[model samples]
Target: MEFQQTGELEEDVWFDDVDPMLLEPSNNLKQRKLSVALVDEEGTDGLTKHVAVDCEMVGVGYKGQESILARVSIVNEFGKCVYDKYVKPREKVTDYRTDVSGIKAHHIQSEAVLRKLLALAMRDIQGQMPISRTFQYLKKEIYFSMTFKEFKDAYEPCKKQVEGIFLLGPLMDKVTDFRRWEEFQDVQREVADIFKDRIIVGHALSNDLKVLFLGHPRRKVRDTSDYKPFRRLNKGSKPSLKKLAQVILNKTIQAGQHDSIEDACVAMKLYMLNRKEWERSNKSKGVLKQTKYFCTNDSKSIKDEKRRKIKIFKIRNLQKKRR
Candidate 1:
């Protein structure tokens, strides 16, 4: 369920620096090890903590040729939302990708742009309220001071009144100059800190890290896409998160638009399902390495022995014919 930062979890697998699998047949490995190498530079070095991460990207290239991070979400082991933020790109954005991303123009627009339009509307609505009422009384009014029960009761039924105010100009032309935004930088820094030296679990993680421009020690990444035991589910190919969740988790995900939090949680769940098996099987990597080495040498020796036998048989036949 949890791992210590240093050699503790590894010690369980490594068995005090001796691979227990050395006792097993060298050729009995189920498959090669499916772990990243232990050479990551920015590795986290405390108690080993794992966080599931998912990122949403929108195109930002020629004809929307490139993908840029528009949103990112991280969830803890207990499936709590730890970090979520919308990332604005540095270049002028080409598409908002409402279909999959659900990001709209207004969501990225600055307070300066939105506040001016909102202030006028707020002023008009403020006039509708009793001007003579004190601020204290206004706070307790029906729209402002509703109880939790009252709010939930009216939420769905009031959609008609709410729908109109939510609509904006089909959305203005996509806003530009996203890279300069301070919020995006702050988010990038926060994500880096959270992931620093911590094991990060995700599907197709390299793409997420690339888009985020963040570095994690490779050893700290437990990518579900490359996980070996799950390979058979997709016929030896790396599985998409959607497929892995459906098959391994017996639940559907990404049926509609992609949700980062949902994907992150699903990846975490899949890993948890096979954690013990995976760690146990990982110990066999040493055996696999040893097996391959011996197998290669054995194959060469067998070929040479057969060649010697064939040559000797031909020599004896020649002598018999001469006799």
Candidate 2:
């Protein structure tokens, strides 16, 4: 799991180049293609090995019905704008969409043009490097110390420990809304910049990060939206952040479309609140006829607990024999 600066493990991790759902065939997309390419600015071969992309779309209805991909932007490993294009969807741009995406029909003459541009841009970025090379490049450029999987696995237990503390709130309409998940090109860069070495707390942050396209070396995200620890451990029915807050935090938090930052903050708060207990008792032995050597929440099953207790007992017995 440990990621070296330049090594085999770093090269082995894989991530998707582009989301297929965005490329769905529609009346507007069939008409044209919208894409762009990166060119060498200087004498140097400006083929940046990594890419980050995001897209914006026009939506129908009050809560975003029939969302149509409208705009996309891509940045290379060097933080240079390698591609950007606007796509015209099948339907007319609604007034509300106009306010959110800042895109109108006039922005894109036709969907055909957008399709061509997008295709061209995809070709250009794809041509720059092979899939294997691109992944290797991302490993070196985006993360440090450990591979994505390793980082995520190591943090999973800790992530679950504080699940009770994190919070989830309604998604907002601001610039960083999750609806714009497709339109976020600088995802990794922005998150790395803001939360470098810091744990990201949120309800169902995995979904947000996936949607936003922010991948950390470690899945340093905490999600409280679901019942599972960080929405993974509860293993029971899926619980909403609002409900979890009422039950765990004993307060009301969010209603719909959970906000990432707010949820992150609440998660951190919850972790802090419960962290003291773990810190105090993480090593404490069970009191008064309790045979367990570790905390009950530490292990999942009774069998596992029994195995741990046996090991603890063996160590204690060995110490006694030595004495």
> Among these predicted structures, which one has the highest TM-score?
1
Candidate 2 per-residue lDDT, tens place, 184-275, comes to 34543553454444444444444434433344432233334431232221223356655555545555554543322333334444444444
Q: What does candidate 1 score on TM?
A: 0.54
Best by lDDT: 1
The worst-scoring run of ten residues by lDDT in candidate 2 lies at 166-175
The global Cα lDDT (0 to 1) of model 1 is: 0.59
Q: Which stretch of 10 consecutive residues in model 1 shows the poorest summed lDDT? A: 166-175
Flag regions of model 2 displaced more than 4 Å. 1-183, 225-235, 255-261, 276-323
- Candidate 1 per-residue lDDT, tens place, 1-323, comes to 24448754553333353333332332222322343121223543232388889988776644665667788988776566677777756555677676787565444545455534433343445446543342333223211344444433433342232333522222212223323333667888888899876778899887787666666655566788877656555545677887776655566667777888888878877766567776566556542233222122234444554575577579789999999
Question: Please, what is the TM-score per model?
Answer: 0.54, 0.30
Report residue 81 deviation for candidate 2 (angstroms): 28
lDDT of 2 at 287: 28
Cα-lDDT of candidate 2: 0.39
